[model samples]
Target: MSSFRLTLERRQQVSTLRSTTTYILGLLLGLGFGLLVLLSAGAPAATLLDDLVIQVFFSAMGLAQTLTLAVPLILVGLAATSAMRLRFWNVGIEGQLWLGAIGATLVALSDFGSESLRLPTMLLASAIAGAAWIAVPLILKLRAGVNELVVTLLLSNVAYLLLQHLLFGAWKDPVNSFPVSPRFDENEQLASLGFGNLHSGIYVALGITLLMTILVQKSRTGFYVDVIGRNRTTALATGIPVTATITLMILLSGALAGLAGGLIVIGVEHRLTQTIGINTTFSGIVIAFIARFNPLAVLPTAIVLAGIYNAGGTLKVFYGIPDAIVVLIQGMVLLTLLMVQFFSSYRVSLLRQSAQQPGQPST
Candidate 1:
């Protein structure tokens, strides 16, 4: 008897050089596919190229807006990366972000804090709210064997509804018909960086990104997280505190998302409006994946995504290109990256069984 078999085995260790190459190739392929789509949509190739290189990226304060948008995207990327690194799916990043804004808004509206204490207190409140939002799901995950992914996603809607309730009801600005909170005091807002719409939040985002990169690449806790992610059984056998590590990571992830929310409120919007919530959660997920969940890579990835977001609006106005085109490109990038990851991580082999010599089962 004979049998044919196909198998896939992971590489014992993949080199950083090879990993980088794979990512670059994936990015090129994604852009190429996006170009084809644009061509099919009646876009002129020369103008497309010009807009992509100049107007969308560098012209007319484009870079500043891109960097500003990147602030929250970077934090959201870090939050998603932390949970994903542990093989845990924290899809509630959007919810955590909204909770952060809520926390910040509550503090901003309160009269208990002194003017000097306002900003710090608001940020702290945001972080705590984000962490607390995740804590409920974490309990479900650990004790009830529930899946965090579904819980987090559903909770995101809840966060949105909660935000709407406050905005349309209590937080509604009396002077205007809009469902928005009062403008934040100058002392409570983040200091500007003397750039177009850019603020100190960018520095905060960069600092956090660097710190996360160091923690993941050069620390013992990072090693433990890696082991647990690779093999839970092995991690447990090696005396790693899998439960505690998971808990810590979950809380940290939520806190980072909350920080993003606070940053958006304090730095950009300056008020809680009906539209002022985590609209970039999907974009952050894209950034994290494009960076291969590497904390160090997340910064550049976030910048790239932020460019697309900022530029897409420009394209809509100047080139008449719909916003959906940008979305199509993002989709292509995500799909191509997944394909690249699969090919780079595993190899398939075919085998044929030898003829059986006895009555025993064929081997």
Candidate 2:
């Protein structure tokens, strides 16, 4: 019994370590492939690698840019993590983000004179809007027994159409002749850090990450969510409010996704546009998957992804590499990580002598 318990504990420890180790291996493989591509392009692979390392680790400005890019990624990653934890697939984070941006745009356009109320109102509206956008799919799943995956994906396209409609019709800047919403009020803009283009959104993202970590690790609601995720029928049998738990989890995920959209507008874009939501939903999925759906792990994963993004611009300018190279690297990294997960979670072993003999008798 003692040895059996020790073996169990050791297995658990190995499983936990497997996730971190696999992620590191995946990143290394991605870097290796990137270098191969650089060599094939006739770029100085050594110089490019050195520059990337220096920019990612040694340059203060580079670090700031990375964090700035990571702010939205962190928020959206958390959103994905939340829904995944509840076994709820809220894949419409892209649409939720757009709705959040729309909400923020509405607030920015309104005549809210009080400077104090401006930021808070925008943030609140974004959260509400995000939740409302997700509620559509949630209701469809709960009430009509729809497959959330299809509903969420379709909604993302719908969001794109909505954005285009607003830009070309109602919210078009008549003077500028551009398909973009009106610029945000100056007061509505997120405060910038002294560093390179970093904004208050970084702080907000960090705060949310910490808060979510605590909520998931320490709260009763979090416990119930975990239980429901692992075994919904068991949770219902135990008198846990499984439906309410699912609803809250979906709403929380949507709110986080919305916060990411709000950050994009208030901190980066300062206006809504047709292209604002592009690729963000997919990026969030990558971040969440890379982190293995752990909210706390999402932080470092977001930073790494952000570094990749920043490096892409530098590569484009210096090495004449296309911007698509960065996307390709991200795809490779995700694929490798998934493969590692498969190996870690399963094992194949040879059959015992007696079993093998019986199975091979006919042969």
Candidate 3:
């Protein structure tokens, strides 16, 4: 008689078939769960399906809005992907986005910036502010070895509070009587690409994605980062400037997130609102993960996520579904994909052995 045991072993490399299968399964499972929720809610599954698959994605106006929403997602998704590639977990990208908006607001509202310099200065200010926002966490991690995930997450709340304080007090729109800031001038706005609801900022985001792809996939600094991600000790022993490299990567990540905020202000919203940029950071993280940290792949992934998220309103209207369902769907997809990622890196099997003999541990 033989006894059997099941064990998991780490894989040296994950095959494309395995990776692809994992993503497909995640997609199907997530949609299945969403369908169950709709049925339980007594909602029409047909309307939900049409809203999700046709209205938001196939309609002309809907497609425009989807791409417009994807602009910020693309920027922030690329930002997260960059840091994630280096194994730097930056959960404060949302805060960086808010801080970036603050910086742009400071410059945009200032009389010192001439009309010619106004927009450019605002964008630059936002990026610099974003980088500055992440600098604190990076320094602490490098010096005191504190956990960045906790610090970054907490800092995000601080950033949101600061944005609220300013909007509710100094930056409050005098005319609107709302908690929103004054809208940017005509000269400061991004033009549409002849498509209603879509802004030219999508082009800028696409260009930046291309540049980042090159920097991360081809540059020597990027190579160092990849190695560091694989093994920090090995990278350090190999004479890589681990601290400096990580610092640069973190700053750049923050800058990208900041730029995204800036674009949202000048392109879509044309002003800062209480809800203008909420939850974007988390959605961007999901986008990055779904894309597998590939900067180039982030384009389609961002668009897909954007279409789904932007359709939340339609789902609510057509099926009486709540916005929470959208969040739940995002979470489920992310969880399933993460599980697939884990499985891709490991193999599971059963080993049988004689009951009379001592069995060795399975690798």
Candidate 4:
């Protein structure tokens, strides 16, 4: 009698063709899985494709909304990519964004700069605030060798609490009696691009994405980051300024995350609210993973995710399905893509063995 066992062997080198094929396959599988999830959630199967694909991507209104929503998603995706490049998981992205919002809010309320320079000043303050917020976890990680992941994740709660304190207390709007800040002046808000809900902030997000791509793919710091991500010991052996390089990248990450928050306030929300960074960090992380942490890929990945989010709304309106179903679909897609990555890096095979009595001779 023979028994067969399955084994997975790591691939020493994966070809470009195989990689591309696996990526496409993963996307298809993920979409199929999402469809199944929708079907189970009581979505009308006949119109699912039309609502999810045509209505979301083909129509002018849907395209505009998706692109508008993609703005912050792109920023967060870039932020996550920057940190992941150095193996620094900045899980406190939500906190950094909130701090960025706070910074921008301060500028708006104080009328800190000339009308012409006010928006620019607010942007600068936002980036600085974001970098400052993440510095706490980065410092502990560098100096005490603490896990940046844990520290960053915990710090997010602190940031949220601070945001709540401001909203419910000092920052509350007096006239409306709302837990929100005063509306931003017209000069402080992002200019509309005359395209549905789209704003000039889309241009800003695109510019930052292009700059980040260059910084990561063309600059010397990027090379150092790649080396460090592969092996810190090797990076140090090669005389790379490990500490300084990480500090730069992680700060950059925080800045981008913070910038996203600022964009939401000035570009979309026009005021600070407690709802500012809700669940956005996780979506950004998903976008980064979907893009395989490539800066340029973040744009397209963000658009796809924005569509999924829009589709979720469609489901709610058309089929009365809850928002939680969309979350479940997103989770399923991420899980599927992860499995594809694993299979792409390894090959599975079966081995057979024959069993015989203790004294019997094997043929």
Candidate 5:
């Protein structure tokens, strides 16, 4: 009996260790792929790795840019994380982001010229617009039982087209002769955080992350969301308001995504452009997945992704490699991490040998 108990304990220990090993393996695999990319580019792999290490850790300017890029990614990733936690797949974060920017642009152009009120007003309007955009697919899913994945993706394309039309047709700035919206007023823009180009968006993103962490870990609403996501049928049977819970989660996610877009306009780009939405939405999805849909984890993950983006610029200037190389590395890393998650959750074990001595106890 003691031997049997020891065997059982050993199995449990192995299982725990397996989970830890899986994530370490995933990180190493991602690094290997990055190294392979550098080798293929004809750069010394060790040197390239050293350079990236320096840029990410040692250079103050590089660190600032990393935080700057992480700002929007944090919001976008949180949006994805929130929807995902409630078992809602909101693939239209990109469209919602565009809607937010468009909404903010409208506010900037309107007659509300008070310096004190402009930023807050635009943020509010953008949040509403983003939630409204997401509501289309949410209603379709809840009312008609439509698959949200298709609806959300299709709406993203529609949103992009709408942005194009506005930029080229009505919102285009006549003085600049560019296919972009007018620059936001000084009062409406987000202020810089310090002497660097980093904006207040970094603080907003961090603040949102903190708030979400608290909500997910402490709030009653979060408890309901967790329950609904883990087992919707069970939750419904237990008197939980599954539909309302899902809707609220999706709405909150959309609002956060809108805030991300608003930050891009008011903080980084300072104007709405058609190119902003091209790949940023997709990047958000990647960041969210890479972080395992954890709201708190999104910060470090976003910062790492931003480092790659910043490093890609350096790679381009110093070497002849294309920027797409960085994207490829990101894709590989995400794929590997997903595989690691899968393996950690499941295992294959060989059947133990029967202990029957000879043919005595075959039964």
Candidate 6:
């Protein structure tokens, strides 16, 4: 008689082609599973698939809306990537985003700059605010040896409360008596690009993506990030300015998240509201992980996510599918991808146990 045991082993090397194929397979499997789930729930599978494909990709209006959503998604994804490179867990991206929005709102409401300069001023202020918001957690982590994850997560609640206070008290729109800031001035708002809900902010998002790609792929900072991520102790011993690099990357992460908030206000919402950047933290983390934390991959990943969000909305509006089901489907897709990613890096093997065990028992 022979007995076998299952063993898990990490792959020594995974080719790019193989890795990509596995991820693609994972996506197909996830989508297929989602289809089955919807069908089981009595959804109109035939028309639903067609509508999802047409509306998310083929239709001009759908593509426009997707691009609009992708702008901030791209920004937030970059934010996560920035922190991830340094092995920093920036769980407060939502809080940083709110701070960014607040910064932009202050500029818009106070008329801080001339009409011609208002938009630029708001953009600058938003980035600064985001950086400032993250600085607290970064300091605590670096100086006080605190856990940034907990601090950042807690700060998100604080940021939300602050946003609520401002909206309900100081910034409420007097005309509508709503818990929202005054609409941005024409000059302060991101201008339309002659498309459905698409705005000039897409250009900014694209440009930033390009810059980040360059930084991540070609710069010393990128090299430092990789080294630090692999081994922080080795990075410090090898004369890499680990502390400075960590600080820079974390701050960059916060700034990018903040910029997304500012962009949402001027580019999408055109005003600050309590609902601004809702679910952004999860979306950012999802996009970052799906893209494998590659800056160049963030754009396409963001578009795909934006399409899912758009499709989810369509399902709710057309089919009356509950939000919970949509969330579950999203979770399934993410979970599938994660499982596939894990398998790509590892393999399980069955090994036969040696017969010597019987001789040893006899002895």
**Which candidate leads in lDDT?**
4
Q: Please provide TM-scores, in order, for all candidate models, with all chains considered together.
A: 0.91, 0.88, 0.93, 0.95, 0.89, 0.94
Arrange candidates, best TM-score first. 4, 6, 3, 1, 5, 2
lDDT of 2 by residue, 237-275 (tens): 999998898899898889888878888998998988777
Candidate 5 global TM-score:
0.89
Q: How does model 3 score by TM-score?
A: 0.93
For model 3, the stretches where C-alpha displacement exceeds 4 angstroms are 1-3, 353-363
Positional deviation of residue 16's Cα in model 1 after best superposition, in angstroms: 4.3
Q: Which has the greatest TM-score?
A: 4
Per residue, candidate 3 scores C-alpha lDDT tens digits across 1-363 of 789999999988878898789888887787688678667765766676677778778988888889988998898998899788887788998999988888887777763478887777878888999999988888898899888899889999999999999899999999987898898888777786888678888888989999988988999888988999899999999999998889888899999999988888878888887676778778878988888888999999989888888778776776677888777878888887788678878899999977664575644
Model 2 CA deviation exceeding 4 Å by range: 1-14, 17-20, 37-43, 350-363
* lDDT tens digits, residue span 139-184, model 4: 9998998998899899899999999999999889988777999999
lDDT of 4 at 290: 88
- Whole-model lDDT per candidate: 0.86, 0.82, 0.84, 0.91, 0.82, 0.89
Per-residue lDDT tens digits for candidate 6, residues 226-275, read 99999999999999999999999899899999999999999889999888
lDDT of 6 at 163: 95
- lDDT, residue 339, candidate 6: 93
Candidate 5 residue-wise lDDT at 225: 87
- 4 against 6, candidate with superior TM-score: 4
Task: In angstroms, give how far residue 258 of model 1 lies from its true place.
Answer: 0.9
- Model 1 weakest 10-residue run by lDDT: 273-282
RMSD of each: 2.9, 5.4, 3.0, 1.9, 5.0, 1.9
Model 4 ranges off by over 4 Å: 1-5, 354-363
